[model samples]
Target: MKLVSLNIGKPAELSYKKKTVLSGIKKRPVQTSLYLSNIGFIGDGQADLIHHGGEDKAVCVYALEHYAYWEETFNRPLPPAAFGENVTAAGVLETDVHVGDVFQLGESIVQISQPRQPCFKLAALHHEPKLALLVEETGYTGFYFRVLTEGKVKITSELKRTEIHPAKITISKANTIMNNKNADREDVHMLSQLEELAESWKKPLRIRLQ
Candidate 1:
């Protein structure tokens, strides 16, 4: 595996409709960078950045990975993503990754914290009526990060697989939580905490449940 691109974007206003209610929301993609600090969350075990409802965050996201790597969608270089990811890696299969998997990028060590879970913001990015349905059909999106060590990383940085586990949660489970309409604020908090468990395991989980 290798890093292909480092991406980031700023927040912008977008419109959404639910029933008879139409609303505009402000959201930003974290600034992507080659270095750790500029990337958002940078720590020894894992790094994190907030993902907007319709955008990607700092660490990892699937984007077009599920769709056979599109060069352009909506006339943009990147497919819809919540926040810009710091590293775009080739040969990093989302489903294949497990908790203990170790990815070596430049001088950095990254572990797969969990599968990426998407939100309503995906509809904003695509402007599609059934964006959520499309995502359910294709599971090649979203990724998580646990930084083992800090170091410089650049576009096209080589991603070496140092370790991986065989048994782990499926990507589908992660999305189930992320996409649940009935999920309350407490549920979201629980999902966030699961990232810690993903750090030490040989294979991180796809979803966090009590």
Candidate 2:
């Protein structure tokens, strides 16, 4: 899998309904290579620390193929980073890769940590309050990566799987279980017990089991 685009941006005021809130969702595509650190790209920023920009979610990746779906719905061509992702990737979809899978990307090493769960930022961006719901219903929610080796990366960076998780819990399965309140208890427990799963993702499932 390779990045079709690389984008980054800082938090800025955004209009949502009648209120203005600071959001880092609007990212601009960049052509130059950027330094990838443990936290994220050097110039990238996340407005909400409580929910974003941690080591386990340093990079947000969305499938380039998803763009076609959105473009068709909107009846317009959308630019890269339209989904606020740091990397617009091609080749691997949520069903193609599993959580904890390690990959050599560009000059850095990274691992899939969790499927991306979003707030209302995306809905607000399009002035469509239910857009986030549509994204979930479509199973187009993206995924995040935790940097293992800090280095440089760019739009041309390709992901070469170096290791695969034995548990084989794909991002599609994670999102399915996560959004399903009636999900099997054993499935929940199994996902929570994964050693490579992010603590943030584990905690919710752990609570549900209780």
> In TM-score terms, which candidate is top?
2
Instruction: Tell me how far the alpha carbon of residue 145 in candidate 2 is from the true structure, in angstroms, after superposition.
Output: 0.1
lDDT of 2 at 78: 85
lDDT of 1 by residue, 1-210 (tens): 555555544444455564321221222333343565423333211112233221112256343354444334434454433333444555666565654466776667766666654455556555665665665656655576667776776554677878754545444444554557455656455455554334322122234333
RMSD of 2: 0.9
Best by lDDT: 2
lDDT of 2 by residue, 108-136 (tens): 99999999996799999877788899999
TM-score of 2: 0.97
Query: After superposing candidate 2, which stretches have Cα over 4 Å from the reference?
Result: none
**Candidate 2, clashing residue pairs?**
none
